[model samples]
Target chain A: MARKILRGIPVSAGISIGKAYFVNRQKERRIPRETIPHHLVAIETQRLRNAVEEVRQGFMDARARVPEELKEHGAIIDSHLMICQDPKLVESAAKNIEERAITAEWALERSINAIGKAFSAIDDPYIRERMQDVRVVGDKIMQALIGTPKPVDLPAGRRVLMAHDLTPADAIELELSKIMSFATAEGGKTSHTGILARSLQIPAIVGVEDLEDSIRDGDLVIIDALKGLIFIDPSEDELAHYGDRKYQFEDYQKAIVKQCHLPAETVDGYRLEVCANIELAEELVQVKDNGGEGVGLYRTEYAFFNKSNMPDEEKLYEEYATLAEQLAPQKVILRTLDVGADKLLDEQAMLDEANPALGLRGIRFCLRYQNVFRMQLRAMLRASVHGNVAIMFPMISGLKELRQARFVLNSVKSELDAEGVAYNPDIPVGIMIELPSAVMIADTLAREVDFFSIGTNDLIQYSLGIDRTNKHVSYLYQPLHPAIVRSIKFVIDAAHKEGIEASVCGEVASDPYCVPILMGMRVDGISIAPQAIPGIKRVIRQIDMEECIELLGDVLTHATVSRINTKVRKRIFKRFPEELSFFASLIEQDDITEP
Target chain B: MEPSGENNSLEVVVCVENELGLHARPAGKVAQLAQSFQADIALCVADQRADAKSILDILSLAAPQGTEICIKASGCDASEALEQIGQLFHDKFEGDT
Candidate 1:
């Protein structure tokens, strides 16, 4: 007889056989109330102080041990250390022990809890996550005061980390090679731990509330991280099935990579430009590795985020220069400072509002913070001297924003000249036509800006007033909405009429089903996520522009979602009948296609 | 500026300093805030008033730095809401603050 194990949701898509490493807990014990020797109180106080210092040093050393890529989060850990060393927390604990005659452990817990309550009162989620950091440092301090070290064991061999929840420190300390996967009982989509896990490419399953209690040590487990599914101890047949599935997935990923260097053309010989959207300079390697034509959009906001203060012009210059150098000749369109509702700059920006998605953000934010925006613009201008760097402004609603953004660019260029910094004077400036207003005035904006990019993500969100982030209303966030299609079509036409290149760098552009519509609209180019490049190209090659235009004509008149979906599906099925049959056969035979 | 509000509307004036005045993000914020109340809200610039609840309408105004704009709100909570909205402009909507 074989035993089975049950656990949390698996976030990454893969199967692996590995050992289990149970997370260790720090020993917590209450000090006896009877231990109050008045003379010893001073010694105990001094001992606690020393212990706090030791823990603080431990945290600092731990931060230093983190990889350079992850060192950006050092400020978060430092903030946590301050929470531990907060005079208010220390004084209250000491007062409680001396006056109420409470145990040191109890006194510490109460004091930390009080501080945590204060943090909880903050309306911002970013600030709220900081509270957890405070708790982590406080817990370590308490452990140190009690003379207990939180034990962490790095298990040998490929092992999955099984825990209730992982702190940011826990994630940073993880040895990449030994870890096969990770599953936790608590965490959300935006947790730093989860983000780190994805960045490390480690399979992870989070938010499995009862996983800690259900699995025993040494139990066999299968984690399918991509589908968020977890399988406990499996039958031999099940194990073998997953083993094959794992190999197939790896092979598929390799196949996608192999296709990277190949031109994104269909069997019929239609070529389409497939570019990558990069967040950091390091990600340029993946773009190059994948044979991306060029970077369609370089999100500059990431440089400002995950830090205490704004990055200065020189700091930003270095970052942009490196990226521009790497992707030289191939253009990099840098979208300046898209921070707003979804990404806040500071605590005060995260004000309580009826709707945050519709709040001040993107170019609007950059405009408000001109000094910061100008620094970014200056950095971008300087980087342009290194390579073909183009500038783009996000969330342009009309001609005014576009004109104003262009005006700032001119000023930055002139300032760079006065300072004798080498810069590109003719760097093409673009606007992201993401709002209906921008779409309506696309002709005017296209004339002013050098190029136009249709940001379908926000275009659809604004056109429908449906918050894509909100799960309940996300279903209504349809990209193929008649109004959205018209808006995109309008921008594309407007850009073409003004002789400006137009491309789309939205999730919709990557969608295979929507490629035909994009082609029909006569977009100059389509920029998609790196992963979706091959499939989108395959779709593009199979269909002719004339046929796509015909399909669009039929699609534009459909009133309901189902009607539009059916029409598009029918058009796609007609164009790629063979591919559809192949897919159906593959699905029938294997029950899954890795791609 | 002439009153851009409808009948029985409250008038509140504010100055624009956000470089890309009343553009996407800020316009979206204003729209989101304006939609919260039962009253209809509108923003005025250079004798033009656009619905505050409509991002397209607000953005078209193209209000720039040092531009004086009037906010008008009508219906329930219009007076209080107009004052609150006026303070957002006075505070520059927390931009660079």
Candidate 2:
């Protein structure tokens, strides 16, 4: 019999065959804000408190079922419960309800909204995510007082969870063992739920449009995570074919792991460095596991963000030092505070602008707040004492910013000297060639800095005049645009001409299909997310640099993005037909099998 | 706690015993205490924070383990906060041992 198939957003890395289990999106009901009678306020408050208690019991039960590894997160829920029961929140809601003669639900909702809005306004994603914790607390209180349905547990048995979005709390509460895979109707690959799925190594797909109504529970499903394909209700022949392919894919992944320690060299003998772009210190494990040469780009902003206050120098130093030590001998290139108009430092630092991407951010913010900049510089410098730590400044427009940054570095050195603390005075400094102006003056900046790392994500965005963060303009943010490629080539050539090392540490570097083009550009290194390292290296090892260089030379002359992309893809397929054929064969084999 | 010294120029150097040192939680506590004092309080760790009043300045000190820090406050309330801050060090800043 012919089988039916469904498509979904691909999030995680592997394929799984499971029964369809729909994770119903919890409906959010907005409570009225009007006040209620005084006597009823006391009654409603008691009712809300009782409801919160019930939800707390449910949370405890959920925690009991979670694996021992995830018990610490349970503490976070406990703290959230505390916030729900906080005398401050309770009393304020009670007072508001009594004075305004509002329903207990309305008063509680208003109080929670105030707290959630306040948390959301903070400049940290970690802390901002805590706003959801506040919502969970309110949801519990509302459920208790207003009789809202309790959050249901994940469906039992092997299945692929389909949902609109899964919060961190929601993800933590899921029975992971029973979940074969997950597909979210909405969410980017960097969302907390996405990260959690990746960490759990579950097959997941995100950003699928209208995925909820298309599939129903108990439907047979096939998820091809590697290719970002989902098949629902397939023929028996297709299922058997995919089952064999899934087994082969698992073997291939194992082979990559075994080859992790091997050099990333093309068939003809050109070697390349495959490094990882690490966001959190804990992610360092993945880098090492993947046999990354070192941290190509350590995003340090995550450490300082999502906090109640600025991370003091010592705290920053310790975190940096730990990463440096862990990657000892291997270099850790730290990109300094990249916050800009999009990410405000505090409410006081807010500059409401029509466009934030072009506004003051990156090194510009550092220059304006010399003290804050100095603290980061000092921390980075201090951390250098532990291992090979290099510093890179972001968003340089011209020579003035680089010179001023150097001046600050010198002043920090003098301070460290006077204080009798040992620091590496000769620590290498680099600049991110993201801005068009930076690329234009790359030769000059290369002369001033120790190295250059092209942030293709921003380079493509700025070169194309597209704001990557803006959903409306996201469609235009193509990395293969010849103009963007030329801009990258210009900076790479400039850095080389000045005898400075250069590398690409953006989303483009992580793409397997783009590895040949990057190699042809003759960039010194490629830094990508840890998970992409092995696959990227595998692609890198299959092609000759000379052929890649020839392909790049031909593609560079193309005028349009589609033309450039077509030429690149054609050259890649022509040069590595075997690899392309393998991938195609895997696509043809449509069965899901357990690894 | 009050400083025993009669001289307003008295200064004491102490080591931060807390695992996080004088990070946000401790720094905020110190800043709050400093606000109460009428003295021109300056915290010096290493060569930084020499002309302090800036929380950012004190933080840049990056004083870690085995590091010595000096707390100097010069007015009437200076002695009180300084004494309390010094005692905090002696008390190990309520740190886990």
Candidate 3:
């Protein structure tokens, strides 16, 4: 048996076996707290200044290396650079060394603790989070003072990188070539570290409890990121098993990519459009490469974030125009400015609502800020003339909200007409059937819109009243729940009745076990992350429509989520055992007591 | 022995005009510019006072957008310090947009 096995939330999927290397640990180091002689005070103060200068230079170098497209990372590094030279930190530590006659490391630790105390009393959670920046900067200075190796100074050869947490700066500074896989003590599914790992196509796990204490530097480890497990000091048998699993996963990956471009048609000749959901224009290459038919959901919020002012209409026009031009023949559905809740814009963060998820967001935020909304609409309308562009409004709870949004779009169109500017007058406008309220009134909404895109991620959350990111209640985030399954089915059926197309976008669309059931419901299309396209498409091509309808019948009859999950899992696992081994499913057997 | 036009102490009220308030980037700019002047400068938000030359101190103030801050400076270049620093708030700390 392995010495120990640790579990965490897997963000990126893959496997690797290598020696562990810690970039930084959460545990406190044994600092030399002894008081220095009065004669040594001047020397200690100079040492502190030199350490700060060294760390400041490192941040400067990292900032310079940051690509133009990743300006967000550069901004974060700028903040760290400021924090490194902040007088409250460096100057106070210098005073601590001079007055208390302590070592530079000890003085710096004292300064950090003092800043942490002040930060703890802050009411705004966003401001409070800035304390982490101070700590990261402080740690770098301490490392310099202690003569510890920086992350860039990793020992020769590839290794599994570990850290308490990876800041944007740390993620940028690390040399990717020397790292095989990485795990962190902090982060979630949407964390930046996970995004980095996925883009890098390496295995990664985050929020790993006990990741630091369980493994030492240079210990041989197996990172089973596919299942979010770490085997420390694995036995010979375990190594052989993982070695085989890794080979199979890579083979499966290649096989899926080779056949990704094929139409998503079942054995019985049933077809469904598979598209990519993307946030940035830069990801358009990934979309085409992954064989996505078009952009299903082009999240427009990226342009609005990390800016001092909202992006102007002309700037937005250029971005959307470029996207529409590049994907000229292919359709792109642009979902307008969905801010608040988890993805807070600067202005919205100040609202500091008691319940932001239910608060002003999506179309509601857009409606409230007409200037911002009007600018986006004008941009989208102008870009529509460039290529196949469809506009989408998110979080439409009812007819009144939908009508209000349409009113604004109509006004924008009229203004364009009066100005004699060119735009697609008959551009398809759609609403995301994300709210349970929207699902209930889908038939009513279908008459007014071009299509229906069911956002199951939010539908499940609002319907179940559970936040999946919240660990204590995440077990209750059952996507296959009877209410959820019924909600999706009802919306699709409603769209069909009104002679419109309905597509599913979210994790449900990507899951192999769930896609078949959606196919049975006859969802017109699906939009998933670009990377998940090939595997999901392969699953679609391999199955028969007859089997999908049968599985849906079985799933619907089972009243409980666990029963539905069990039945679906067994059937899907039997038919696609090889494919199932490589894919992670939303339907887990967590509540099932028997086979 | 002071020049007639020169002032030893100055105070000016400035509102945070940037959408993100006085976050790290803005705070860093304030500190960097303040360090260049020889004035003993401080920013007063509500009852709290933060050193204008310390990013940590300014961040701890946690002043969001639209909050009024008083820039206080006392030195040979105090008037020059207030005018230039207050201008940063007006311009949203340059290159922000």
Cα error, residue A490 of model 1, in Å, equals 2.0
Tens digits of per-residue lDDT for model 2, A1-595: 3254444434467778877776656553323334455667678767666776777787777767777899767656555544555544566677767677777777776777666655555553544555565677777777677465445555457778877677655665567788988887766433445556765668787766556656656677787775556677867776887798778777777777777767789989999888888767888888888879999888777655546588899999999999999999999999998875345566325666566678778888789888888999999999999999999999988999999988998999999999988888899999888889998989888889999999887787778886654434555657777777788888889989999989999777866557677788898998877766776788887778888898788888899876776666666767656444334211121222322
Pitting candidate 1 against candidate 3, the one with the higher lDDT is 3
Stretches of candidate 1 off by over 4 Å are: A1-228, A232-237, A266-269, A347-354, A566-595, B1-97
- Span of 10 residues, lowest total lDDT, candidate 3 chain A: A586-595
Clashes of each: 11, 22, 0
Better structure of 1 and 2 per TM-score: 2
Say which docking band candidate 3 falls in. Answer: acceptable
Instruction: Provide a comma-separated list of chain B TM-scores, one per candidate.
Output: 0.82, 0.74, 0.90
Instruction: Give the poorly placed runs of model 3, Cα more than 4 Å off.
Output: A1-3, A18-182, A186-200, A212-221, A233-240, A306-309, A589-595, B1-97
The Cα error of candidate 2 at residue A400, in Å, is 2.2
Model 1 agreement with the true structure over A426-503: per-residue lDDT tens digits: 888888888888888888887788899898877877888876544345447676778888888988898889998899
Better of 1 and 2 by lDDT: 2
